[model samples]
Target: MISGLIMDIMGLHRFAFHSQVGYTWVILAFVHLVFNWGKVKAYWRHRFRLHPHQDLPTPPKQLQQLEHTQKSDRRSLFFSLLAMAGGFILGRLLPTGQTVDFSSQKTDGGMFYHQWSKLGYPQALRAILNWGEQPARYKTYGDARQIELPDPKGYQGLSLESAIATRRSQRDYLNAPLSLVDLSRLLHLACGITHAPGELRAAPSAGALYPLEVYPVVHRVEGLQSGIYHYAIQQHKLELLQPGDFRAAVVTAGLGQNFLGQASVCFVISGIFQRTRWKYHERTYRYVLMEAGHMGQNLYLGATSLGLGACAIGAFLDDALNHLLGLDGQKEAALYLITVGRVETG
Candidate 1:
């Protein structure tokens, strides 16, 4: 079991079988203890010298043996504690040595990152150095014009099961304008602040560090300008980044997907790496992409629940989309795109 655990921690073996072995070992250990319950009880009493009157009168040789055993146990416990304390102190005092840059490694990039980010003893110790002030949770544009989105609550939509059953990647959309309320609800259900005190959202984030920024490139939303706008999650409002038509640019950025131009709103999801990177370190890339997936699924279900169409786009020109969103394609970069609009039904 110990060997399996070590292998799993080091990313040297699959954890499913290792975990099964561990669980089975635990069950066997439990059964062994059950069968030896009386022996275990007697040993515990002898070890701790509990209830001396209940124990048999010991021979002089047995008495000496017990004394020696007690002394050895005491020494073992003292040394064990001392070793733990010394290890902790050394880990804290020692500077982290040079870490290999996984990006420059000749190994497969994804596998290299996986192995490098594996949480082992050394990596856990190095994490102590990563502690400090956390980055701001929300990205804001204070000077940009903000549009008040309608109260997204109290809208009766499809049941959860129905939504999941009907949810699909819909690329074909009708040439009709989407209502402002529909847009409001979509954004709300996607990543709105669900718990105000904790600043939690509709989608779960790693450590609640919401690194995602949502930008809606409006094409035909009613009572809204045709331009790019950021969703202000804290205030539940839309912040207009640029007020102009970008249908052509969005289609080009989306690799000439005509459906992007046809959709009423194309949601661009970007991740601010430092938000999660400060805490997660090497695992930051994994967490940010996972958070993006959570947000994307929420959008998919939300669109489906509202009886609208939504399609996720992954094959987009990253640099082009980043440039369009005024992102530097480093600290904050576009990760995924989902286009939502009205769809024809039979």
Candidate 2:
């Protein structure tokens, strides 16, 4: 029964890859059993020689054929089973994606291996075909009233140097809602419309294509209900995309990371490559990520200046998240998320 569970655990990648390696796991399991059998026989023989006649340690001979095996095999079987149980528990309790690598190179210090993103133009095209959702009818966002602060220029860490020096990602946050003035300043500094008159908001774009969209998940902001609101750059407001913080969905979308659910606010950045891909085709994905990076850095800097806590989260269930935001994830693909709040103090 335990081995059957092990097979299932080992065969996950095989099934996902659609490869014929599932049989290999079975073979490896047997090879492991055989290696242990010899070691168990040696240990048992020594035990008998030492005492002239003594029963082997508990666990019986039913598991891994240990009636005549060496001592090491018995020990190996016990340790292996213990490890398997621990691994099974960890695997079940954690996000199904978590895993531990026991490679010597990793222990000695080496780049941790990561799965390549299944990103391809084909996948994007396939997703786009399913993008049959009605076009978003953007509406005027929250009731925003501009208010004055203690010192407009003096608020954010005095100099740009200090702000940059202290620009660190923060997860701990306060409970205070963002003031309207602070909201205006943060949005204006971070990815707000710039340069061109009545047009051209983002600082840089693939052919000024500006393929990204920012949605704010307002949880405790003042004058704003707990909801997901899209930032309308042109109109200078937050359009209610979907109501409520929806932070719980974000937690799932973020692979159940605890930080996500705890965040006071989060920005969902999506890309509509059609704004650029119409000309670049497959290569447009690269530009979209780069543009999103620019916007993300803007948020980081803006948040640092405002002295509010912020964190840029990249690992997320891309497809699942876009669906939460009512996006088909074809014309619009979720690129990244920036969660913000007050700094938590011990």
lDDT of each: 0.86, 0.66
Best by TM-score: 1
Worst 10-residue lDDT window for candidate 1 reads 1-10
Model 2 vs truth, CA RMSD: 18.5
Off by over 4 Å in 1: 1-107, 128-133
Runs in model 2 with CA error above 4 Å?
1-158, 344-346
Residue by residue across 292-344, what tens digits does model 1's lDDT show?
A: 99999999999999999999999999999999999999989999999999997
Clashes of each: 0, 16
Clashing pairs in 1: none
**Can you write out model 2's per-residue Cα lDDT over 81-105, one digit (the tens) per residue?**
9988887786567433333343444
